[model samples]
Target: MVVNVSNLSPRLRQLGLVAVLFGAIPAGLALMGGGYPFQVGITALIFVTLAVSLNLVTGTAGLLSLGHAGFFGVGAYAAALAATKLHWPFLLTLPLAGIVAAALGVIVALPTMRLISIYFAVATLGVGEMIHVSLLNWVSFTRGPMGIRSIPPIEILGLDLSGVIGGYYVAATVAALAIFAVHRLTHSYYGNALRSLREDDQCSAAMGLNPVRLKIEAFAVSCAIAGMAGAVYAHTASFISPDSFRFEESILILAMIVVGGLGSLPGAVIGAVLLIVLPEVLRGIGDFRMIAVGVFMFLSILFLPKGLLGEASAIGLARRQLGAAWRGDIGAGWK
Candidate 1:
C-alpha cells in the first residue's frame, strides 16, 4: 500500500515534487483558510528563490558573497521604480529588476574578482553596506527611509492577483521556475566547471577555464535570479523599505545555505523553508522564538556539521533519481 518514492525514476520524482510544491501544499493551505499562512508561504517561496540563487555563487562557484541582499534590494527598488515612476507593468518590471541587479553584479565582480578568501568576503560586505547607505541617503531617488508605497500587485493582463491565494500561487510559480533553472545549471558540465573553480581556481585556469570570466557569469546569473525574487516581494508585499534588505538580511540568507549544506541545490531549498517556517511555527513560544531558532541552528551545526543534507549525499541522490540522464546511459553525453 505504501509507495517507495526512492524507487521512482528521475522524471517521475521530479513530477511528484512539482505536484507537492504546486499542488498539494497550496491545497492544504487553502483548506486552512489562507490568511497569514499565505503570507508566510509567499515569504518562504521568496526566500527559497533567494537561497537557490545564493547557492549558485557561494556554494557552486565557491565565492562567498556578503552583498546578496544588496542585489536583492536593487531588484526590488528597480521593479518599484519601474512600476511607480515609469508606469511599467509586472511583466516588464520583473525583467527590468533582474537586468538592473545583474548589471550591478557585473560591476561589483569586475573590481572584486581578484580578491579571494576573507578579503573577497569583506569587499562584498563593504559593498553591501554601501548599497544600504545609498538607499538610506538617496532621498530624492529611493524616497529615503520612507520606502516605496502603493506599489501595484501581481497583475498580468488585468487579472488582479493581490489576494492571499493568488499571491501564493504567483510566488510558488516563480520559486518553482527558479529551482528548475538552478537545477539544470548545476547538474550539467557547466556546474562541473564551477566546481572546478571552487576546488582550485589556479588548477581550473591551468585546465583552460577562465576563472574570472566564470565567476563573473555565475555572480551575474545569481544576482539576476535574486532580483527576480525581489520583484516578486515588491509586488506581493505592495511596499518595500531599505530596512528590509540590510546586512542582517544578507547574513540570514547566507545562514540558510550554510545550514542547508553548501553546494547542494536541494539542501538550499530545504534550508530556506526550514529557516522561514521554523520561526513561524515557534511563534507560540512568545519572545523566545528567535532563541529557539538559535538553539536549533546550534544543534544542527553540532550534530549535522555537513548539514541536514550534505553535498555528497545530495549529488548521489541526484544521480540516482536522474538515472540514465545523469550517467549518459544513452550515450548522448551529459545533458
Candidate 2:
C-alpha cells in the first residue's frame, strides 16, 4: 500500500495509467448514473478515435484536411448498408467499412496529391461537400435523407454488446486501440518521415523521401481509421444519416487537433475529450453553455498557443519512454 508509483518503470507506469483511465470510465459513469452520462462517455470515446486518426494526416503529416467527416460518413454508410442490406455481421462490417473508406481516400489522394497549402484544403472541402450531397441526393442508395434505421447493434462471437455499459466498453476499447496504434506510429522512424513532409515537402522529396507516396499512404491510413470509428458510431447509435457527417463535423475534428496541439498525439486526445466533455459539463449553464465553451476555446488558444500537451513535450515524453525500454530498464515493453 506504500508503493512508490513514481519509481515504477515507464512501461509499467504507462500500463497502469491506461488501466486506471479505462477502469475509471465505467466507475465515473456509475457514480454519475448511467443514462445520459453513459451516452456522453460513449460519444467522447468515439470522438477520441476520430481525433487520433485525424492527427495522423493533419498533425503528423502536415496535411490540412477539411473533408475528414466525409470519409467518416463513408464508413458509417458502408457499415450501415452492409449490415442492413447484406445482413453482414458486426465483425464483417467493421473492417469492410474501413476498407471502403480507405479506397475512397486513395482515390481522392491520387488526384489531389499534387495540390498543396490552401489549395489542398479547398479541394478536400469540395470532396466533403460532394460526399454529403451524394448521400443526400442519391435517394435510392442512401435512403435520400430518410436515413438508415434499425441497424444492428454490436455483436461479436454471438454476444450482443448493444446496451449502455457494453456499448461504452466497446467504444473505449476502440479508442484505446486507436491511441496505441497512433502512438506507436507517431513515435517511430516512419512518423519522423511524416513530420518531415509536414515541415517541408519539397525538401523531403529532394532527400528521396517520395513525398507524394507518403502523403497518400498517410491519408489512406487516416481514412481507414476514421472509417472504423464511423462503424462503431453507426452500430452503437443504431442509426445514421448524411447530416451526421457534414462540413461542420469536419471543422469540429479539425478544431480538436488545433486546440489540442497540431502535431501532438496526446494533445489530440486531450483536445477531443476536453471539447466533448466540456460542453456537457457546462450544460448547467443553460442558454450560455455554448458561449462558455467558445470562451474556453478562445482562452485556451490565447494562452496556450502550442496546446495543453504540445507536440514537443509529447515527443519528449515518448522518447523517454522508448529510451527506458531500449535500455532494458522496462524489460522490453512498448519498444
Candidate 3:
C-alpha cells in the first residue's frame, strides 16, 4: 500500500499522509481527557463517516441518493428489534443492522441502477419518505412514534460503554475506520472506475465497464456505512423515535457532503465537522443561529469555490508550481 501511494503525485501522497494524521487526532484526544460533550463530537464524527461513504457513491460514482436516511432508520430499528425482541446483545445487533441496511440498499439499487441525476434523486427521496412513513405507522415493529426506551448500553466483553467518554472512544474508532475504508476504496481500481463513470458514463461503458454493477455496488457500500453510524447512534443515545430520522437529517447529510466539496475525502470530513460545530459556535447569537449557519455556508461556497480544503490545496500547488518554474523544471506552467 505504501508503494502504491508513493506512486501517486508527491502532492497527493503528502496530502494523504497529512489527512491520515488529522483524522487520527480524535483518537489521540480520546486517550487523554474527554467529557460528555465529546459525544457531540462523536456524533459529528459519525456524520463524517456517513458523508465520506456517501461521497463514494455521489461524488465518485456520479450516483445521487436522497434515501440514505432510510438506511439509517432501518439500522436503528433493526438494532432496537435485535436488542429488545430478540434479546441479542448490542454488539451483535449493530452489525446485523448494517447487514440489513446493506441488503435494503442492494434491493433499492437493483431497480434504480438505470436512473441518473434528478430522476434518481427524486426516486430516492420518495423511497426515504416511504420508509419513514412506515416507521411511523408500524407501531408493532418500530413501537411507532412513542419510541423504545432504556436501550441497554453497548458492552464489549465485560466493559460497559455506558459513559459518554467511553462512547466517544468507540465512536471515534468506528468513524476513523469508516473514513479509512473510504480512503482506501477511493484510491483503488474500483474507485478509479467509479470516477471514470462519473466523468462520462457512456465512455466508461464503452470501455467495457459495467456501469450498472458499479453504481449498485457503490450505493450498497454507502448505505452500509451510514447504517453502521446509525446503529452506533442508537446504542449511544439509548433511545430512538421516528422523529429522530426525519427528512431534515437527510438534508444535513447532503449539506455536509456538498459543503465539504465533491470528490474529496478530506473535504467530506471537514464539511461534517464544520457544519456540526458551526451551530454550537453560533450559540452566542441565540435565535440567529440558523441565519449564521446559512451565512457561513454561503461564504464558504462563494469564497472557496472548490471548498475550504481544496482552495488551500490549490494555493499549495500554486506555490509548488512557482518554485518549479523558478528552478527551470519540466514546465513553465502548472495545470
Best by lDDT: 1
Model 3 per-residue lDDT tens digits across residues 1-335: 25664346656765665565444555555565666446667778778878887788887787777877888888888888788778788778878888998999999889988888899998888888988999999997788889888777788888887887667667776787887677657655677788889889989999999999988888888888888888788888889898878788888787787788777777888899899888876788899998888898888888877775663453344344335432444332322
Comparing candidate 1 with candidate 3, which one achieves the higher lDDT?
A: 1
Point out where model 2 deviates above 4 Å. 1-6, 325-335
State model 1's lDDT.
0.91
**Could you tell which candidate, 1 or 2, scores higher by TM-score?**
1
The candidate 3 region of ten consecutive residues with least summed lDDT is 326-335
Q: List the residue pairs that clash in candidate 2.
A: none
Evaluate residue 16 in candidate 1 and report its C-alpha lDDT on the 0 to 100 scale.
Answer: 92
| Deviating ranges (above 4 Å) for candidate 3 | 1-35, 311-335
Per residue, candidate 1 scores C-alpha lDDT tens digits across 151-251 of 98888889888797888888888899998888878887888899999999999999999999999999999999999999999999989999999999999
Residue-level lDDT tens digits of model 2 in 157-192: 998897978888888888888888888887766888
Per-prediction RMSD in angstroms? 1.6, 2.6, 6.6
Each candidate structure's count of clashing pairs: 0, 0, 0
Alpha-carbon lDDT, every model? 0.91, 0.90, 0.78
Ordered from best to worst lDDT, the candidate numbers read: 1, 2, 3
Q: How far out, in Å, is residue 23 in model 1? A: 1.3
